[model samples]
Target: MWLLETTTLKPQLFLGDSTPYYAILSHTWGSHDKLQNLAGYVKIIRCCAEAASCGFKYAWVDACCIDKTNSAELSERATECYVYLVDATDPSGFGNNRWFTRGWTLQELLAPCSVIFFDSDWNEIGTKASQAEFICHNYVAQRMSWATRRETAREEDLAYCLLGIFDISMPMVYGEGRKAFRQLQLEIMKESTDQSLFAFSYRLNIGIRPIVCHLLAESPSLFRECGTIQAPGDGPAPEYSTTNKGLRIELPLAHCIGGFYSAFLNLTRKVCNIREL
Candidate 1:
């Protein structure tokens, strides 16, 4: 593991299992800032100071810890860093923090055994365990909600950044555009039985109004197939494919109508009433 030397901000290598406790900075990277420059160094310095305050001698900041010019090093570091201190605090508090909306931040939020949230001013807000109820109920939906809204400098990064979330790894292929996201979904489906992975927007019409609705109604178990496959050692990889046609399901008209009503009713209670809509 490469750690930032707290004093000189130099990269130092340490054995993965033998490393000392360290703090990680998880924040959105601005398009214009160069990590070697003064503006970019500010966040790194602040994070290092924060780690020192917490009795940690080492810190890891993605901007400085990984050598972006070396693709191999970048890939290695991406999965190595797990614990994260997500900056989720804004003037409006944790609810409105932009970190929650990021595609890469989704993995940062879930994969870690523990995650601490800090506000814009670097004040302690809470931990992921403390916010269990909110995260459990809304985690997947929250990811879907902002998956389209978050921005990445490289389009392929939209999917590459999420490799750790599904515990899957692949070589970075730049210039794939939106195809990267499709490949990501295929990889996820091979390893996971979570139907919520397919809980993305789809077209539905109630009366004369066409509306966007989430497949499986944000339920992870609804569409999950009940079975398991035992692969032989050195067997072939699982077969999966993606098509331009959106995810489709075949069901009786009554069942489809009932699901729509149930989803609509659930939305009404949480967000708006039919009259308000």
Candidate 2:
């Protein structure tokens, strides 16, 4: 008879946290004399502090959140977390911005999710551009699934799952982005050619930069001078339709689709100005 070691196996579990909101704050490495760029680090700290005031239950800051000595543990826990704050070095670095932003904010960054952005100005900028596009995609998909395919779908349950999914999915997305980029990187390395990751990243950068820029240029009014305003509801409710048109306004919310899309695009283009710069 072979002697067997007695050990208990633990089951993997995902009991969601009760915290209503979470945030991630990040900054590029700090070096003396790098004041201009280093300003981002200060802004990140302030942003995290502001988030806590906004009722975020938890906030992760790279300076204190991660244990650099323990890669194994970091890798494991990183898989499940909420929020990922990022700051890009420059405008041309949109590819880096997209990958890291998307990677750290995965489910919400792609497919479907709620997202927020801390702009270069320290104002959170996630309303009617890339962030909105990502959220709309998910919302539509969810509505589609519930209406036509699901038998036990519940709106409350969807809300619960949506928040948690945003948390855990980000790190996984980051890993995937790294892996995909690495494969392309290796191809360039092997060829020993003029091509590089930067070259391949150009097309992506061009497309994303304009979309975001134009969207912001058009919606400067939404952001305004105030950082954020508090509304008496779960959150700042998205008003998708409005029929207040000058001389005589009379309509229900149901009849506001035409104006909604028009306002959305017009404001987006004006605030963002992707076309000009």
Candidate 3:
């Protein structure tokens, strides 16, 4: 079903209360075209089911949730959107910065109230080398093809797939890939900072577009985290200090692949369009 009107989805705004949690509906591939699209929708419902099992009461997904038609409302609602969904993947020069949240879109970097645990054992899957196998075995993917076009795409995707898919062997696989991806990502950021023209392109490709995707992804995360989702406010914002940190930003390949597949399915709705495996 389509999302309700913007007015209908406009959640109540609060002062100090926390916003709902959201989950990313990444990954949407199938045996055929129709099945591929159906997979995207399935991820949304699956997120809800998994979240509910983890004490979460709500979730926000873009496909059947947000009313993108209302530009005014969407933009307005976007500012305080940081309450959930901090996309670790941005083409921005800050891709490697563990402190990248500071540059998050108005839609990300907000407070979270709930969390969804998929109990995904991607690390144990035998087909960890292939993204499709990762999804088929555990069902996850958050990256889009557009983002994967960069130089670090392969290594990053490899790390993500291996990190979340393999249970025992993930450490070695993830370490090797992470090291390589980090090196390449650092080079890109350095080039952008040193050169003038390169900096401009970097902002357009990595900074802006990734921020948009992140904002959209946060919706579902907010719903899943918080008991009730709502609009954000300028009250007490979340704190992020470089000196004080924990897990750095890292979006697994499953997440990226899932997002790509879902987006593709959404773009092409050819009835059960079957293609090669």
Candidate 4:
């Protein structure tokens, strides 16, 4: 694990214990050469400066510090992450910041113990620790809804980046495409008995033919309308397990007209903005 020494007097490595407390940097990489750009170079310097001010002797900026060629480094964790909003100039413009739309940033935003936000010029904005009210209490479905608006370059990253957010880790087989998301849910099922995992449906506008989907959500985007769903009560769910054929479960579904059955997930919907817990 390589770390950037805060002092820019010269690029050098400082000896440290195996597990050193370090600050992480989260920012949007430009399509053009970010390493070659002057803004990008200054951003790294500013990050080290900010980290020094935070009393951290070491900092890890993903752009240049990470050795992408090494797969083992992908498993590393940080004490906190600093998010530099390159497109945001002030607090009011944050809602439209490009950082929020990035898929990789989703994990960066939720994974670390503390996340600090900074403006383009390195002005302090706020921290996510005190403001993250939803993560601790929100149900699986509702929490998954937060990533609907985010995107990744590779379709597989739509699920890969969410590894930390869900506290699940699996082998990263990039070319599998949408199967990665399903693999993520399967891994989540191992950690959680939350029945809301199955409470996903496609929300299409009128006149659009309903697209066929699997029992599990294909991507976080499918969890968009799931914002209103709530977790089930304390009642234990019927014994279930994942198999090659799919999830084998005993559900008490109600019979409906036209030979259809309705499976109430023991969930209630408020049908309004569910931003609050």
RMSD for each model, in Å, please?
9.4, 19.6, 21.9, 3.4
Model 4 TM-score, all chains together:
0.86
Candidate lDDT (C-alpha), each: 0.53, 0.30, 0.27, 0.76
Give the residue spans of candidate 2 off by over 4 A. Answer: 1-21, 26-41, 71-113, 127-277
As a whole number from 0 to 100, the lDDT of residue 22 in candidate 2 is: 43
Query: How high a TM-score does candidate 1 get?
Result: 0.60
Which parts of model 4 are misplaced by more than 4 Å? Answer: 9-17, 134-137, 204-213, 232-239, 270-277
CA deviation > 4 Å runs, candidate 3: 1-19, 28-41, 72-277
Q: In candidate 4, residue 146 scores what lDDT?
A: 73
lDDT of 3 by residue, 79-193 (tens): 1111121222333322232222121121122222221112122111211122232222111111111122222224434333222122212122333644643333233333222
lDDT of 3 at 116: 19
Highest TM-score scorer: 4
Of the two candidates 2 and 3, the one with more favorable lDDT, higher being better, is 2
Best-to-worst ranking by lDDT: 4, 1, 2, 3
What root-mean-square deviation over C-alphas does model 4 reach?
3.4
As for candidate 4, its clashing pairs are: none
> Could you give me the TM-score of model 3 versus the true structure?
0.25
Query: Can you rank all candidates by TM-score, best first?
Result: 4, 1, 2, 3
